[model samples]
Target: MSITNNGISIVPSFSLEKPATVFNMSIAKGRFSFDPELAFSLEAKPWYSLFWFRYNLSPKQSKFNMNVGTHLGLNFVNIPFPNAKDSIQIQKTDRYLVLEIFPRYKFSKHLTMGVYYLRSHGLDPATLNALNFVTLYTEISQIQLSKKATLGISPQLYYLNIDGNHGYYLTSEISLSLQNFPVIIKSTINKTFETKVEGSKPFLWNIKLVYPLKGGKIKP
Candidate 1:
C-alpha cells in the first residue's frame, strides 16, 4: 500500500525471481506503470493492471548490465463522447503490449546510471494510443544516517511521445528507509520543461508512504 499526497494506492503485487537468475516476472496494479504506459487516474481508484517479464543479458560480474522486458496490460479508460454538449462519460476497456529495454552502469556501491526505453502498442486502435517513452537517470544510494537507516535519491530526465505529441520532463525521487522496517517514505517531484502535448501538467509532486507485506529488503 502507498499513501500519496493525492490519495491512497493499494497495490497488490506478485514477484517471481530466483537469486542469481537471469529471468524475473512481476505483476501489479493501481499505479502508473511506464512499461506498458498503464495510466491510472490521479485519484485512489485503480483501473489498470500490468504483467512484466524481464531477462538480464549481461554476466553477473559485469559493471554494465542490460535488461529486456515486456509488459502486458489491461486498462479501463473513461472516454468522453465526441459531442461536447453531452455531459456523460463513457467507459471502455483496452489492452496494450509494450517492449522495454534498460541498461545501467554501476559506477560504485553508492552510484548508478541508467537509461530506460519503453514502446507501447495499443491493442484497440479505436480506444487506445501508442506511446514511446525514454528515461535517463542516475541514482545515489546508501547515504547512511544510522546503522539501520538509509537514504536514496534518484533523478531522471525523460521524454514522452504519444501519437506524435511529445514532451520533455524532469523528475526525481527521494526515499528514506530502515533496514528492518516495513514502511518506507518517498517523495517525488516532476516538472515539465517543454511540451506540445495537451493536458500535461507543468509541475506535480507527491509524497508516498509504502509498506512491504512480504519478502522485501531495503537495499537503500
Candidate 2:
C-alpha cells in the first residue's frame, strides 16, 4: 500500500503487509514541562514483529520535552550456510531488547533541537548484541505553505555502532499536511557519507502516503 525510492540495507522492510497501531494519552500534569503521558504501539510484518511502550513528558506550553521508551522486536532472518540439507540458507530468530531516550528543546514555534539515543541488545543469541545509535537533529515545523496546507522539515545526523563497526549517516524528513484533506504525504532521504560497516546503503529515499479514516466521512 506504499512505495519507496530506495530500500534500507540494515532493516529490509521492503515487503508489503506491514500493519501497525498506536495508542497515546496524557495522564497527568503538575507544572510546566512536567506533563506525563503514555504511548503504546504494536507493529507486525511477515518477517518481524515489534512492540514498544513510551513514557513522555511533554507540555504544550513548555520549551523542553523528553521521552523514554522500550522496544521488543522479534526478527526472522535468513543466513547463508556452507552446506544445507534443504537449501543454502538457514532461518533464525533474533529477539532484541531496545532502550531509547529522546530530549528536545524548542527554540521557537518553528524550530526545535533534539538528541536521540538508542541501545539494542539481543536476548536469544548473545553474540548478536550491543547495537547503539545516537542522533542529533533539528526540526522546523508548521511552516505555512498555503491557506489550507502546512509543511514540516527535519534533518538529522546520526552515528551507528554495531559489533565494533561504526558508521555515520545524514537523514531528512519532509511532510505536507492539509487542513481539510484526509491524505498526508511524507518523504524521507538518507545518505551514508562515511562508514566502515558492511551492508550499509550509501543512499536511500522513500515516500509514504497516509490516508486517515476521515476520508470515508468527508464530503466532496
Candidate 3:
C-alpha cells in the first residue's frame, strides 16, 4: 500500500511567471485476491481532482504482472497576477484524460522493474485550446531495504504537445511499514526539468500514510 499528499510549488514549463503553490492528496488500494482484480485510486486537491480504476492481471505468481488503467481528472488553476489586457486569470478548469498500461517483471525476490506508458489529454473551454497530453513513465523498485522498509525511483518523460509543453522529472520514494500493523508511512521528492524554464523547476515534497482496509497486494 502506498499513499501520498503533495505540497509543492509549480512554474509552468512554457510560462515565465511567478511560481504557484499547490497541494494534492492521493489514495490507492489493490483489490481482492482473485484474478483480474480491480485496483482503485483517487486524487484530490484544491486545484485538481482525479479518479482511477485499473485491472490487475496477475494472481498467485511472482515472475510477471500487468495492469491496464484509466485516469480521469479535472484541473483548476488561478493565475496570481491578473492584467486588464489579459483575460481574468482565475478559476479556469480543464478536464483531463489518462490511459495507461504497464508490465512488470520480477527478477528475484528483491528486484523488479516496469515501464508505463500514459496518454494524457485535456480540454480547456476557457482557452479554447483543447487539452491533450502524452507521457512515458518508467520505474525500478527495491522490494525491501530491510525487514521494514521499501524504496523506488521513477522518471517521467512528458510531451504535452497540445499545451505546447515538454518536461521530465525524477521521483525518489521511501516507505516504512509499521511493525505488527498494516500502516505505511511514505515520503517522496520530485525534481523537474523543463524545456522552457531557465533552471530546474521547484522541488516537490509529498507525504502519505497508507492503510489498506481490505485487499491483497496488487502487482506492480
Candidate 4:
C-alpha cells in the first residue's frame, strides 16, 4: 500500500480493487529544516478517476504546530468504493469537504502528544443527509539506540460518534532502524478493545519498510 524510495524522502502509495470500484494512488513529500521554524507536506490522491490534493503546514518549534487543508474534485455522491466486490451493496458516495485542525506539543525530546477534533457533514446520496463528529488522542515517542539505529513508537485513541452510533478504538506501533541499510524495519500491533456494546477486539501485525528523505536526524 505504501512504499518509500531508496533513502530519498518520497512516499508513494496505491490501492485498487474490483470492477468499477474505487482506485487511488498518492504521492507525498515532507520537509523539515533547522531554520525559519517551518515544515510542509503536499499530497495528491486519485479516487475513481477524480483527483484530490492535500497540503499541510506546521511550525518547526519544539512545542506546537498547526495543520490546515482541503479537498478538491468529486463530492460525496461520487465517491467510489474500494472493495465493492466483497460487499453485498455499495454504500452511497458522499461529497468530499474536509476541514481538520490539529494541535500538537512535545513534552520532552522523546515524548510528544496531540489531540484532534473534526466535524463533517455532507449528503450520502442514499440517506441524502450525513453528519459525524470525530475526536482523537495521540502520543508518539522516540528512543535512541546506537549511532546508526533508533526506535520509535506511537499510540492512538479514537472516539467516533456518528448520528446515534458510537465507537472507540486503540492502536499502537513500534519501529527499529539499522545503519547499514537505507531501510527501517517496523512492526505494528493494533487492537480495537470495544465498539458500541459488542466486545469486538481485533489484532493486526504489519511489517513496514521506511526510507529517510531529507531530515532523518536522531536526537541524542
Candidate 1 at residue 70, lDDT? 85
lDDT by residue for model 3 (1-220), tens: 4344443322122221222223333345554211221122343324445566677787647578887877666665666455557565555667766666777777766566666666666554554243333334445556567775665654444443334544555555565665567776766565665443334345666676766556344477
Write one digit per residue (lDDT tens) for candidate 1, span 41-95.
Answer: 4453345666776677877688998888787777666678778687778767788
- Residue 215 error, candidate 3, Å: 4.6
lDDT of each structure?
0.67, 0.66, 0.51, 0.46
TM-score per model over all chains:
0.74, 0.72, 0.57, 0.55
User: How much is 85 displaced in model 3, in angstroms?
Assistant: 17
Model 2 TM-score is 0.72
Better of 1 and 4 by lDDT: 1
Q: Arrange candidates by lDDT, descending.
A: 1, 2, 3, 4
Once superposed on the true structure, which residue ranges of model 1 sit more than 4 Å away at CA?
Answer: 7-45, 79-90, 216-220
- Specify the highest-TM-score model's number: 1
Q: Model 4 TM-score? A: 0.55
Stretches of model 2 off by over 4 angstroms after superposition:
1-45, 57-60, 78-91, 213-220
Best by lDDT: 1
lDDT of 4 by residue, 92-134 (tens): 4445353456677778888777776554444334441323434
Error of 1 at 63 (Å): 2.2
Report how far off residue 204 is in candidate 2 (Å).
Answer: 0.5
